[model samples]
Target: MTDTPENGAAAPTAAPQITSRVLAQYIRDMSFENILAQKGVTGDAQPEIQVQVNLDARKRSTDNQYEVITKLNITSKTKEKGDPLFVLEIEYAGVFHVEGVPEDQMHPYLLIECPRITFPFLRRIVSDVTRDGGFPPLNLETIDFLALYRSELARRAESEKAKAN
Candidate 1:
């Protein structure tokens, strides 16, 4: 302000501003292991599968950017010898610029839209891996991220309601 501009007026100072808004996506790792059950059911085998998906959400040093990672583990096999039929691991991430978004609206954006945007590619990769593994192509069940998020919210609300009741 160099002596307050010599007129009893304060000099203008620079205010901090938001720097960057970017969405970066990458595939960290993926693996498909098919261990065909040996000397066990092959024909007429009603293969049983166990599907598990895990999500990890994180915010970096920046206030506006967030990362949502989804990991899938699929194990499909018969019930005869406890053998592993197919195991798939997919680790994928989506980064988003969430600045200016209300705090109340953050959960849905991360849990639903981010994952929905990342799922089709993940699904395609899984299908390709399974098909190339000399087994029937595995078509993953459709994921309803919005529905899942809503269900979670509803469950929480119900629990609170029950507690109050």
Candidate 2:
């Protein structure tokens, strides 16, 4: 039953509340190779690091459940000699139970928001792996998911435009 105002007009229905929960998070795969150690390079080496990130999302068999994966590839090379230092690759995934997000916004929510929730853990793992692999801990700067998403969209638009021409 809807509550009516004193004038007896019907009240508008309220919108459904948005809800989301992370069901599980895990490192689906990871690998770290210390190339400097294998090469027997022992002097003080300044490192230049490059990091690449990619995201993916897919629906689960269970209703209202989705899995999002963040893939990272990181490489470090010596600044002076351009020698390989190390390479780290990881795929991290989160399972989320979500409700009330409009379909149009669901893609962004899964790709942007879910990865935001899981990134800190992924960063910590990177730092730990680098330190354990015989280099100083490599702390990653925070990622701007919104900017990344926007750039990806722009790239796709450019690709489509090129194809049409």
Candidate 3:
């Protein structure tokens, strides 16, 4: 966006646009707690840390296409509280609607834009959960939405190419 003016006459801008509106949002579900049972890991389990992560996204079929939802879950386990730690599972998902929009624009917005809008809350949740679990806040690393978008496109392209062949 830019302002253009000459001779003190301002160019008229287009009418106000509301891209998407939140229909309804509430905590779908949430849980956070510390597992004191973890202490037994040091006595019996192998000295190993296990980690797994996943991501999923979906869009509503309604015409408005203005509603989006995302959830992130992370579970960590270590050989012992004082030993190396690992993320047993990190499942993140997003639901979005981009109706009345051009496909070219919506693709990136869903993959990148929506996440940009939602990541802060997700990050705060992660940090708070970790801290409440008796560990230092899990200040997550930054994400590159553009890179993720490119990767999604590449994956789709590869899948289509494979189908064609």
Provide TM-scores for the models: 0.68, 0.90, 0.57
Total clashing pairs in model 1: 0
Tens-digit lDDT string for candidate 1 (14-95): 5534332437877888887767734444555556878787777788787678888888889887776566677888898888
| Candidate 1 weakest lDDT stretch, 10 residues | 13-22
For all candidates in order, the CA lDDT equals: 0.76, 0.93, 0.55
- The list of candidate 3 runs beyond 4 A from truth reads 1-18, 23-36, 39-62, 67-100
Could you tell me the lDDT of residue 120 within candidate 2?
96
- Of the candidates shown, which would achieve the greatest lDDT relative to the real structure? 2
- For model 3, residues 87-143, the per-residue Cα lDDT tens digits are 322333344444445655765566667666666766777777667766677776666
Provide the RMSD of all predictions against the true structure, rounded to 1 decimal.
Answer: 9.3, 2.5, 6.4
Candidate 1 regions exceeding 4 Å error are: 1-22, 37-43, 79-82, 150-165
Residue 21, model 1, lDDT: 42
Model 2 segments more than 4 A misplaced = 1-15, 42-44
